[model samples]
Target: MEKGIESIFKPYLEPKEVYKGGKNIPASTKKIYKLSSNENPLGQSPKATEALIKAAQNIALYPDQTDIRLREALVLDFDHKLAADQFITGNSGSEIIDMILRAFINEGDEVIFSNPCFLPYSVFSRWYGAKQIDVRLKDFDYSLDVEGILNAITERTKIIFLTGPNNPTGTYIPKAVLEDFLARIPKNILVVYDEVYRQFADAEDYVTALPYVMQGYNIVGLNSFSKTYGLAGQRIGYCYTTAKIANYIRQIHKPFLLPITSIEAAIGALNDKEFIANTVKTVQDGKIFLADAFASLGIKYWPTQANFFIIDPPLPEMEFTDFLMAQGVMVRPVSQFGAPGKVRISIGDQEANEALVQALVKIKTR
Candidate 1:
C-alpha cells in the first residue's frame, strides 16, 4: 500500500457480521431468515416487478436525465404539497444524504445530530470535513434532546440531521416537539428530515416533515422506496426541499443519477396502494407478535413506531446476535449505532417471526 494513500481518502465504515454474511454461517443450516435490514418482509409489488422487467428491454438507453417522471409520480402519489421541480432524485437515500452534504457542507462547518443516529450522518460529515456535534439522547426514553441540540448551535453550524423513527432505535420525534424545535432553529441552518421508514410508522402522533418544506422552511425531507416498496436492490430515493436548494444540488449532481428500471419500478410501486397497505399490516402484526413474545420471555425492548425495535438480550449484544445467527436467524447487534448491549430486530414474515421466537426460547433455556 502507498504511504500517502491514507491521506487521500476517508476510512470506510465496515458493516457488522450480519451484513458480512456467509462467513460464520453453518454448512448444515437451511432456509436462513434475514431480518437484519428493515426491509419489507412481503416481497415487492407485482406491479413494480412487472415495470422493472418491462423497463429492462431498453437497458441500452440512458435514463431520463432530469428524472421528471419519478418526481411527478412522487408528488401525485405520495406528497402533493410540493411541485415536481422541488424534488431531487438519487440512487438511494444515502446518495441524497451525500448530495445534501456536498451542496451545503463546507470544510470546518458544523453538523449536529443525536448520538446513535443513522451511521452515515457522521461518515458523510467527516468525508466533507464538517465538525460534528453529537448530542446524547435523553437517558430515560432514549429520545432526542431538543434542548441540547438548541444549545449546541453555533455560527458555523450548517446542517442538522433529524431521523423520524430513527434507525436502530426506532424512536421518533413527536409532532408538537418537532414543530417547536423547528420554530426555534436558526433559519440559516438547514434541517434534514430522514424519513425512509415513514410508511411503516403507525404512531398516531408521528408526523411527516413535508409540510415544513411547503411552508418555505429550510428543511429537506428524505424518503426511499427501498423499505416501503421492497426496492432496496434498485437503489432509488428522493428528497423534497426548496426549489433553490434543489437547484443547488442539481447543479453539482451528474445527470442520469438513477437507472431507467429503478425509476419505473418506483412509479409502479406508488400505484399499487394495496401492496403498501399489506406490507404495513404485516409489519404491524409481526411487531405485536414479537413484542408479546419478548414480554412473556421477560426480555426488555424499546417500543417502536417503525418496522424494527431495539431489544436488550440476556447475554452480551454480539453473543446474542451470534447465537441467533447460528440458529438461522439474522438480527443486527447495534453497538455500532451507539446502543450497546442491544440488538435491533426487523419485523419479518410470519414464519420468520415464529422462528425468531423459537430461537429466543432456546437461548433462555440454555
Candidate 2:
C-alpha cells in the first residue's frame, strides 16, 4: 500500500456530509424555505445568463488556460495597478485555499489563525502537514484575536488565515486594529484575508485588506462568486495578490482546472453592479430582521455584519437544528465550524425569514 494512503491517512479523513440547505429542495415541500449556505436567495444576475448563453458553444474548446476574462474583470473591479500576472482562478474557494497552503507549507511549519474560524482553513493547514495554532476568539462573537495571533507566531510560523465578516460569526476586524496587527507581523509571513462576504459589509469599519495587496503587503484575499452572486453550484472562485505570490500560487495549482462556464458566470457577475447592490441590501435587511426577531424571542445572538449570524442554542445545536428542520426551516449547525452550542442561520428572503421566526416562536412557546 502507498505510505500516505489507507490507515495512515484514515485518522485525518473527514466525511463531508451534504445536508439539504435551501439549494436543493423537493417541489412538494410546503413553503420550502431554505436558509442554509448563506447564499444569495435573490437569484443570479441576468448578465450571467446572457454570458452563459453566449459562451455555451465555446465549452468544446478549453477554457482560457489563464482565465483572462475573469482576471480582467476582477482587476477592473479592484481598480488598482494589479498586473495581469497577479490572479489565479480556481474550481472553488476551497480549491484556492488548498493550492495556497500547498504552495507555502512544508512539514512541521506553523499556521496560526483564529479558533471558530472557517471550518476548512484549519483542515487545509493540517492536510499540508503544518501545526495549527488557534487563537481563541474574544467572546462568543468570534472576533479576531490580533495580539494572540501575533504572540502565537514563531520562526516556524509560515501562514495566517484571517476572515473578515467572518463566517458563522459575521464579526469584522477594523482597519486600525488590522494595521496594528499587520505592522507587528514579520513581512515574510503570508496573511490570507478571506473576504468572501466583503460585499455584504455595510459599515465603514468593515474595510477589506485589498489595499494591503495594492501596497505590496504580504497579504492575499480570497473571494467566491458563490455568496453574493448566487454561483455556488457553478464553482468559480479566485485569489488576488501581489504578482510574485500569485505566480507562486499559480505554479502550485492544477492548470485548466476551471471550466469555461464558471469563468463566464464570474465575469458577468463582476459586471453586474445592480446584482451586488441588491444582494447586499437584501442580506443587510435580512440580518436586521433576524436580529429583531431574536430579540423579540429573548434569544441571545452575536450581532453580525455578514449574511449569517450565530445564536446560542437553547438546546444542543443539533437538536435545535433538527427542530427547525422539522418546522420547515433549514440552517447551518456551527459544530463543524468549532462552535457546538451555536447555530448559524443564513438570512433568507422575506417569506423564509417569516417562517423561521414562526418556528422559533413555536419552539419557544413549547
Candidate 3:
C-alpha cells in the first residue's frame, strides 16, 4: 500500500477548533441570548432579504463568474475611483485570505502577524508550510507593537496580516502608525489588511488602506458583506488591490465564484445606505450599554473600536462561559486567542445585552 498522504498534510490530519457562531440552547431553556458571534443583532438588511427571495427562483442558474455587477456595486459603494478589474470576489473574507496566501506564499517563506489578531492568519500560514512569526501584543491592552512587527521582518517574510479593530481584542491600527510601518517595509512584501469590521469602528484614527493600494503600494484590503450588511449566511467577500495583484488572485479563483443569491443580496445590501447606517448606530449604542454594564460589575474590559470587546471576567473564562451558557446566554472564551482568563463578548441588541449583564451579575453574586 502507498503511504497515506503528503507530509505537508500531516499537521492538518487532526482538525483544529474553528470559529463558531452562537448555539441553539437546549429545549428546556426558557430564553437563549446568542451573543457569541459578532453578528448584526438587527439581522440582515430588508432590501437584501427581498433580493434573496426574488433570486431564489433562479437557483438553478450559475452565478456571474466574473462578478461584474457585484464588483461595480462595490466600486460605487467605496467611491474610490477603483476599476472593476481591481477587485476579486470570494465566498467569504476567510476565503479571500486563503487566496492571498496561496497566491504569494511558498514553502519556507515567513508570515508575520500579531499573536492574537485573527486565528486564520496563523492557521493558513501553517497549512501552506510557511513559518508563522507571532509578535506578542504590547501589555494586556492588545495594542499592536508596530516596532516589534518591523523588527520581526526579514528577507524571508513574504506577507504580513493586519486586522483593524482586531478580533477578540477589538484593537485597531491608527493611520499614521500604519503608514510608518508601510514606509519601513520592503516593497517586495505584501501586506494584507483585513477590515471586515471596519464599519463598526467609530475611531477617528482608523482608516482603510485603499489609498495605499491606489498609490501602488504592496497592500490588499479585504472586506466582507457579512458584518455590516448582516449577510453572513450569504457568504460574500471581496478584496481590492493593484490591478496586477487583483488579476493574480482572479487567475486562482475558481469559475462560478459566488452563488447567484449571494450576488443579488450583496447588490441589494450595497444599495441600502440607510440600512447600513442604522446597523452602525445600533452597534454603537450596544457597545456603550455593554461598557456601562461591565463597569457596574467591576469588570475590566479593553477599550474597543469594533462591535465586540474582551472582558476580564470575575471567574475563569471557560467557567464564566459555562455559567452564561447555562443561563441561555452564549459568549466566546478567549483561550483560543491565547488569553485563558478573558472572555470576548459580541455586542447584541437591547434584550440580549440586558440578559448577558443580568447573567454576569448573577454569576458574580453566586
Candidate 4:
C-alpha cells in the first residue's frame, strides 16, 4: 500500500504563521500613505533604472552563470578587502539563507536565533527538519541576550543566526559585545549575520560582521541590494564568507539563479553613492522627526538603528493597525514577529511621515 501524502508530511507539519507585510489600501480609498514595508522611501535608484533598462535590451541572453562581473563590482565597492571568490551572489539574502540551510543542516540538527529575529530563519529550518531554538532577547531594550544564546548551544547546534539592527525591535549588537560572544562560540558552528540594514545604522558602536569573515571565523555576512540600494524589486543580494564555505554554498546554489536585470541593477546601484547617501540621510532625519513626535505625544517607542521602529500602540496591536488603515495609513502589526501588542512602522517620505504623525494625533484624541 502506498503512503498517503498527508502521512508523508505529518511528521514535519507544525503550526506556523507566514510572514505578514503591511496592508494595502482599499481600492475605493482615494489616497493612502504606506509606511508598512521598510521600503526605500526615495524610490528606486536612477542609476539602477538606467542600468536595468540597458540590460533589458539583451533579454534573449542568459545572465552570467558565474556572476563574475557582479562579484568584481562587489570587490571594488568594498575597497578590495575581499576577493571575488569570497562573495556569493544570489536572488536575495533570503535565498542565500535558504542555500546555507540546505548546505549545512542535517535532519534533527539545531538552529538557534532570537525569538523575534528574521522570520525566514525558522521557516527554512523547519522545512529541513532542523530543531528551532528561540532565545528570548533582553527585555529593557530588546537587545539580543548573548548569555542566553551561549547557554543554549549544545552538541547538536549547527548554526546560529544574528541580526544586526534586528528587525521589529531595531536594536543592534555592539562591536565589543559581539566580539566577546564570537570568541567563546565553538568553532564548528556557523554564525550567520544578517546585516541587510547595516547602511542605515549610525550607532557609534555598531559594526558589520565582515571583519570576522576575513578573520577566518565560520561567519557569513549577508547583504541585500533591496534595502540600501533601493532594489527590493530587483531581488539581488550576496553573502561574504570564507572561500571554503562559499564553495560549499555555491554547490547548493543553482547556476544562473538571478536575472540579468537584477545583477545589472545592483551593479549600477553601487555606482550611485549619492542615492545611498541620500537614503541614509532621509531615514535618519525621518527617524528623528518621528521619534520627537512620539515623545511629544507621550507615545512609547524604542530606539532603532534600522529604517523602522516599534511602538507600544495606544490600543491592541491589531486594533491600532486597523485604526491606522481606516485613517488611510498602513503599518505592520508585529505580533507574529514575537512583538505582541506592538506595531512596527517604517520611515516614509516627508509627506507620508507627516500623515502618520497626524494619524497618531487622531489616535490620541480618539
Top candidate when judged by lDDT against the true structure = 4
Q: Estimated TM-score per prediction? A: 0.93, 0.92, 0.95, 0.97
Using TM-score as the measure, which candidate wins?
4
Residue 124 lDDT in candidate 2: 77
| Model 1: pairs clashing at backbone N, Cα or C within 3 Å | none
Q: Rank the candidates by TM-score, best first.
A: 4, 3, 1, 2
Model 4 misplaced stretches (Cα beyond 4 Å) = 13-15, 24-29
lDDT-better candidate, 1 vs 4: 4
lDDT of 1: 0.87
* Candidate 4 TM-score to native: 0.97
Model 1 per-residue lDDT at 256: 83
Q: What tens digits encode model 2's per-residue C-alpha lDDT throughout 1-366?
A: 566556566443455422232346546646667777887879787888688888888888987776777788887887846776788888888878888898999878999878676877887777767888988788745778777888898999999999888887888888888888888899789999999898888778677877888888899889888899889888888888988999888876665777888888888888999988888888888888999999989988988878888888676887898898888888877766767778888888888899999999988999
Q: What is the per-residue lDDT of model 4 for residues 182-230, given as tens digits with 9 covering 90 to 100?
A: 9999989999999999999999999998889889999999999988888
Positional deviation of residue 121's Cα in model 2 after best superposition, in angstroms: 0.9
